[model samples]
Target: MPPPGQDPRWETMGLVHDYLAAEFPLINKTLSLAKVNTYGLIYEWTGTNSSLKPYILAAHQDVVPVNPETVSTWTHPPYSGFFDGESIWGRGASDDKASLTAIMLTLETLIQKDWTPERTIVLAFGFDEEASGIYGAKYLGKALEETYGRDAFAFIVDEGGGFKDVYETIFATPGVAEKGHADIKLEVTSPGGHSSVPPVHTTIGYLASLITEFEKNPYPVELARDTVPYDNLVCMAAHSRDIPRSLKRAIFRSGHSNAALHRFEKDFVLQDKFYSSLVGTTQAVDIISGGVKSNALPESAFAIINHRINTLSFVNETAARDTQTITSLAESLGLTLKAFGEDVIPESFYATSHCSSQSSSTSSSKGHIELSLAFNHELEPAPRTPTSGKESKPWDFLSGTIKATYYSHRAQGIKTETTATDGDNVDFDPRNVDGNTDTKYYWNLTRHIFRYNHKNAAYGSEIATGVHTVNENIPLDHYLEIIRFFTTLNNECR
Candidate 1:
């Protein structure tokens, strides 16, 4: 995979393309492979039955840039692609190169076996996903729409939630949905004055109070069993033997004893780092600026609040609610404020109006407060992929392949260890991915978008698939398991 923010060279992709063009001449002649937007690669293995909508296996061919200062800290060089007799160490080893390799190898194997599908299969690889898909999946999605039309895919699969052991049981978590993202900007302006003669609170001081309010009153938490994350906990409780019986019973009877279920989830499930993100919209005051000089009270203050909207709420709604909360808080603090974005006045007009309205209070109205949400990029919560009913065939096939990948080894008198005890068969759990993937750009192509990558570890061992960090690597055995899963899924997805 090429490093992030660069052109979609897809050096690995080009190599695979050339190899297939030479080795599998028949496949080269039959399947349609094209580079979309000069960066995204799309390979379509046309099916005998054109009536069936195609299935897309999507993965990216880009990795985040490694910090130069951290180079000496790595066991192997970041881009060395070293095999240390146990795992492959490199920057993109686990994140996405593994998935790309698995897809190409699976296709090559299928072509060698002379295998043909009844339904079409598409392999879509985006090259600039790490830099936010502007040049890759976004254009690929548009090209696909022009070629295959909207809703032309049976399902789209991408790298996201993976199989992991939790509570002594393997949970095959295919990310059925993902959280939305937004960046809100807050600003305040006041009459400039000498620091010695300033009011009780300056513009920066009011901004600080607003930030405190946001932290004190975060988005409300919901633990209803119907929610995706809570439901997943319920599924885990039902399958894992390590969970307390009382907690399992509370989860099972969540609908009947709502308070008990909420308490149990808040005390137990939310304690985990992964599950804490799912319950509510998370707010972080990531950036702040104020005060230009030590001798003068600054006239302006600015802050940027980043939010990850939970699957339970819509992005627009979450933003609106937060705007209201901030506006109310500012008003309570005796600050004359005007909110921005959705039902709030335009920033230019609001600032101008405030500039004209002279001295409403003894302290010149305790400074004019401005709340605006200038979203750098915003995305709504992804559509939830179905896990039940006839339309869930793709999910069922993917889960079955994961199960088969681990279970086949056990059947051969091989000991397979998950986070669970040896010989414990892992079960599948449908849940939303906490992080976003390239699949976000392809939502228009299909409702059945699944974000999954295989990564369950043996009990007491580290899950070494560290993304965007130093010492990134993937266990060789786990890499093989990924390939096996993809091979099985490729053959069975129809």
Candidate 2:
């Protein structure tokens, strides 16, 4: 690919495709494999022939469009592919471009080093992943099942994991499961009337009151804390049992006494600001409208409150549906409810059809597991009890990966535990489940779904900044760290 001489967006896709598919062969592949607007382009690289099954390594090539004028805001050119001493800079530097570069650079280096593993390593670059990968990865995944049985992949690596911090230090965390998206829009309407002859409360007034009420205390459903974060944290803290112990103790004791007041306050705030928000239900009012104009006295005001649940259920978790229920309870007094954008609710069209939820450690899954899901796939909340699938099993695969790579850096030979990063008590604060990508696609399949990114490094609060904003930035050092992660992963991929 050209070394960022020109803005890559125009010819960038073609160049990337050529490099991965034709030029270096591995690095430059397909620009749009699916070839459909929804599917986007793709590039694939096959590993050297070997008896072992292949591993699917994925990263999307399509980047979020940048502001044409302010592109210079990038310290290093977004597409320069330049490695500054401080850090490599670019758009998608952290969100996913870093991940993409990692695999690309790893393969380029490995191929040059004349290294070939026992398994066929499949490196895929999707063109349209920035839009949730419906076409790129999803379509490729379908093709894989058709070509090889469902179990063809030993494992697949997507942008689920990234480097983060446990305390003030950098902690490399891998995502095992991401919360699913359940969008709920609570719309409240009241009798529309003129400002001159108001009915005590307008629709906007009523909806605002309902929102105020919901805000008093979010729905209190529990989230299943995926064992992965805890494992990473324990490892990050060097297995210091004291930290988590103190944190957990605080969670329990905060409710009981004033004696532990200070301890509880400090600990609760940290936990709430750090880990608790990741796995939970969250709500926010993004839009609302009721009146048409001034003077004439319009009727009807509506509040559109968006909600996402951290429940085990696939895409569109509890809060999306529960918003209505919450509104219903508050409506009898005179408020009306209506949710807009319900039509845009995500539909799951595919499932891990070949794999079985019943597979045991020793069980072999069917050759192919892909199923079609309807657009309006309203999944029932999974059993309150957690369920595990071989595809989505949170176990040594995750913990082992982290341990093998970064563990050696540690002084102690401590072992780490792995579990799905689900919401055990998500509803406690609805913020965790807001209409966000954290758990959107995860709710649909039983595969491992983890939501993590590098930006959290700067935000001491560990809150997600709803992706794509003017201030979107990640540390250059962290960007390099993620690149190194791919280096470690490829070296250790089993």
Candidate 3:
């Protein structure tokens, strides 16, 4: 993967493409393939019936680059593709390559069995997802929209949350929505001078104060009804075995009572930082830089605060909150404030106020502070995927498929059925992705978007398995189960 704004190096990706072509000859000959931006792969298997809408299985071909300093800490080489009779160890083993490989193998198997479908199946593989899919899915999305028009597909499945044991029950979590994203860049400028003659506060000092103010006030957490997190909690309360009785009752009542909802949020959600972050817009000052010399005062200082906006909020709202956060401090420091190119505190107003004050006699204003979007990428929260009622047939079908996959993989001699009805083997729930994925670009192609991979989260320690970190690996049985899930989905789709 490349850095945030840099172009990806495609030498290794080209090799992977060649390897796929050589490995899946039947799929290559049967399906139509197109390369978008010379790297993004799109494969389409046209169905016999043109009346039914096609569905897409999306995956990324790239993985986060491994750190060279951590190479020695790995049990196996990051790129080895070594299978120690249990798991496959490599960089992209679990994050994405697993899904891509599963889709291909599923298609190849179906082709070998001479199975023809009434509904078409499309596979979209982007190469730069680790860097926000700028050069990959962005073009693939356009090509897909041009070919099929908007809302052409029945649904889209991308790599995301999978099945995990929660409260002693196996729950399959398919991401029904994703949070919004923004990076706010805060910059402060002041007069440079000798350290001995420095003013009461320097540029760095003012920036620190602004950052402190931001931390002092955070977005409030609310358990709004109909949200993904709320729905997930309801499912947990309804299906999980070991939830506290009182908490379960509160979760049930939360659907109608605002008092009960806030109580649940206070007692449960707010108690955990992880849960609170998912419910509210989160902020983190990831990057900061200031002085170049110690002998002289710093002329300018800046910091980039990353935000994952809640599903209920928008980019403008977040920016407004940030502007309000530091306005008072900026005014007290006699600094002009310009937020997102709009002047909040004008130089003349501060100068006039300073002159009018009895204690302050200076007519000239102090330096200014500017707030702007760090990157041009500002995404609104994704449209929620319907998970119930008549319009949610696609979601029901997916949930049934997940249950069937889970049962058949574990129990022998059990026939796998893919009906959109309740079953006894496993439970399903809608969840939200805290971060964005390649699905961000394909939103217009399908209203029913599911971010899920059918891997069991209980296979190993999540941090130990190391997605985007050291010792990344996937169990061989888990890989086979993913292929099984895809095969069943393709077979069951009408």
Candidate 4:
């Protein structure tokens, strides 16, 4: 696969589409198929009732490229679809191909059975999701909006969260919200000179200090009620028996008492890095560059700090906090500051903030720091899908379908009949995705977007599954279960 912003492997993507067309002839013949931007696919299965809004089942065709260095370490060759009687081992087996194949197989089976839908079903398959979805989903989103108008779809199901065991209880978490994204570039400039005649601090030194300041002050994590993380906690507390008595009590009491919430955050949330990141904005200095030669003093140094903004916050808030973090240190170092194209610490402020005893010659030696958005890709948090009340009928229906699929998969071939009820062991919860998905582009198409694939994530280690790494594989039964889930969902849709 090509890197982000570069032209994708169009020929490679075409082969997958061609295979789909040949493999699922029934679906290809029945549905209205159109190719967007040469690779992105859209297939619409018209329904009997035009009054009801259509819903989308979305997946991506691309998978992260396999590293050649790790080929020898894989249990089977990365590209080889080796089925060891129980699981299929390949590069795209688990991350996304499973979902894509399941959706296609489900539709084909439904078509073979001569079943027509009351509500329309749309399938959106993008070609470059792994590379930030610029080449694929972006154009596809524009085409979809132009054809269907904004918010025309009832709901959209994309690849995301799945069922997993949390504290001994089985919970299915569908990502109803996704965090925002930003990449802030910090660049510092100084007078270049011989290394022997360098000033007290060079451009690289100032950049290091700024980075330290950012790490010193992280975004505070708060456990607010009605939020996705809090809701997940509530479900765990209500059903999971492995949680400690004190923590469980705190989680239950947190709804009504601020003191309990604080205790829970301090005791549980902060103690667990994963939970803390879920509730707070996260920052990481991902890229840095400095001097080219050892003999010369560096004239400039830059670093890009990536941020996954919290759902409750906006991009502007994150930028503001970044500016605030290094302002004092930059001023103390006699450096002028500019952030997001606005003058933060002007020349006058820099002159006044510096020590008066400093000579005029030293004033000319001061450098300037500039902060700006990197790559021009700044996105606000996605709108949270409604999970309750009258507007959440789609969510309710999906939840029921998930429960039914779980019960049926386990009770297959049994003589006894069973019904999915609230008392059943399974719990449905809404969760927030820390990273963005292709659904990021489809936000305008549907407010009821669910990032989910009904796969069980409790089977193996993340590395063993090879989602974006080596030894990628998926259990055969799990893949079949996904097909069953999608089939049941299509038939049960009202």
**Model 3 alpha-carbon drift over 4 Å, by segment:** 1-8, 357-362, 413-424, 459-463
Candidate 4 collision pairs:
none
The clash tally of candidate 4 reads 0
Whole-model lDDT per candidate: 0.76, 0.45, 0.88, 0.87
What is the C-alpha lDDT profile of model 2 across 2-25, one tens digit per residue?
122243444556676556555455
TM-score between candidate 3 and the true structure:
0.94
- For candidate 3, give the lDDT: 0.88
Over 4 Å off, model 2: 1-51, 64-85, 164-171, 188-196, 221-238, 241-271, 296-302, 312-404, 407-467, 470-481
In candidate 1, position 220 carries an lDDT of 68
* List of clashing residue pairs for candidate 3: none
Q: Give each model's clash number.
A: 0, 59, 0, 0
Pick the lDDT winner. 3
Model 4 stretches with alpha carbons more than 4 Å out:
1-8, 359-362, 413-424, 459-463
lDDT of 1 by residue, 133-207 (tens): 877888888888888899889988788766666676777878888888777888888788899997888889888
Alpha-carbon TM-score of each model against the true structure: 0.85, 0.63, 0.94, 0.94
| Candidate 4, residue 392: how far the Cα is off, in Å | 1.4
Q: Is candidate 3 or candidate 4 better by lDDT?
A: 3
Across residues 14-35, which tens digit of lDDT does each residue of candidate 4 receive?
Answer: 7898899899999989999988
Clashes counted in candidate 2 amount to 59
Model 4, global lDDT = 0.87
